[model samples]
Target: MKIKPNKLRSISIVKGQLKNVKFCIGDDPIPTVSEQPVKSLGRWYNASLRDKDQVQQVRQDITNSLENINRTLLPGKLWRLQFGLLPRVMWPLTIYKLPITTVEKLERTMTSCMKKWLDIPRCLTNISLYGKGVLELPITSLTEEYKFSKIRLQMTLKDSRDQTISNAEQPIPSRPQPSSERDRKSPTYALCPTPATLKHILTGCKTSLTQGRYTWRYNQVLKSLAAALESERNSTNSLPLRATNSITAPTFIREGQKKPNHPPTKPETGQLAMARDWKMLVDIGQQLIFPPEIAATTLRPDLVLWSPSLKSVYITELTVP
Candidate 1:
């Protein structure tokens, strides 16, 4: 084997041992050995052998990357962070030893950047950002990713692989019967008459339904949608339809040919522009009564938008499920 002295560097793992270490290539003394950290495999290792510096470096890199991403002012920042920044962050987490606290801090920083990208208030809970919420978004949780990565790494180890094979070869065991009274008890809620399973809590709890819990949640969502529609209804930017008798200019003509017999038809503006007297009603604190002249229906919708001049009515029913 051949050696390149200039490309080589060394570091002692034991404290106070670097002073006694020396290297030479055929008595041409190689003086690269020191207590300072040496770069190896894209990571820094020092005499102490602690991962503090490496972790700090990784943290700094992540912070800088997030800052740079935030400054770009580009769309789909969430996607960029998820696909671009998170993978790079996960690489170090999987390769290097990092404490949960460090991962949490990094996640907090990332979460802050995500809030900016999403244009949401910081007061929003982290669970709402990563977990199932009223407004579900595609966001990854760093701590969960770290845990999964660790599990994946463990699965690749020789012991784990051997154990997995051994388990697969063994006969399947029968399902265990309830051994204790507590285990045999059917789960139930104080207010709910039925079993307190996830499905019951989410949809089938008669007590919750009668208490208006479902109605409150439905109204909350409907309120936001109605507010947005109200703004659009009041806006004056809607394109008005061209008069039927008005003539439109020709859009195009061939270089050496005469204009066509008929002019290109103007795109139809929606019925919304027909009249500006737009009125909106929402079923919130009070019950919504369907206009008698429009339908005289017993069923009430969440929202109603109508224009008397155009005789147009828009009924919207909001469903959370």
Candidate 2:
């Protein structure tokens, strides 16, 4: 049988993409500039019926994503490997430097691609081929360091025909970190608070209005918390009043956010000050007094304490940096 004719009959394996993919068969293996079948011939997995079902499900998912096309995939690459009907694939003359993106953006792109791959098994892996054909990859892998998700790829086939691998795409972008491991970023100073301290201060804040200090600044606020600490101890039950309006950063890898019912930022002078004051006081005072009323002897100044004997408020000196 002639090689081209056999190639035509060959299973047009287009695997290794995530969702919503289309596959077309042609004389040449490279799908880019090769002849089209007028319309897309549908998905790739030709031989296995079970694989076809998988291909369809993945294709539909990907199609929906592409239609919505708002989110991203990460920590993986969506790679496509094709086997030439003539054996080896040709390095086609195409532009590779498709676009530049931040580490996050590239990750999203690579994620979308992997979702493509997740949709199907990579076509280029584990296949038999005979003739020599060009592998035209617009993208090239410069460093093995970027092992995955950096838009880096290489092409190879078992048989040889005058096969060439060339890079037409622009250079791959660099990684965010020098190390291969995930970068562990600390929480933002504003969003990240010492939970112990916050409880202490909020427990104390309820007394500010009663103490004839309806409106006070940060320094006065600390003293206000001290008074609240004393009151909570004298009471039969002590618990910081639940804050009706609170804000928090909902998700990491995103910005710190105000909790719903959180006071708004408007009219020039904002509630951010109130929030800041509230957070600082609550963080500090709650630790000292934000708990069920307890026997005075069991308490310590480090975490919380009250002295009925001397009638004094005690707080471990805070090291304000």
| Residue runs of model 2 more than 4 Å from their true location after superposition | 1-147, 150-227, 235-321
Please, what are the lDDT tens digits per residue for candidate 1 over residues 45-85? 66556788778989999989888887886787789899999
Give one digit per residue, the lDDT tens place, for model 2 in 7-125.
Answer: 34322335643332234335444232123221123333333423434334433443454434334344223223222110111111011221233223433443444445457444533
Angstrom error of the Cα, residue 256, model 2: value is 72
Q: Please, what is the whole-model Cα lDDT of each candidate in the order they appear?
A: 0.75, 0.34
Q: TM-scores across all candidates? A: 0.45, 0.14
How many clashes in candidate 2? 53
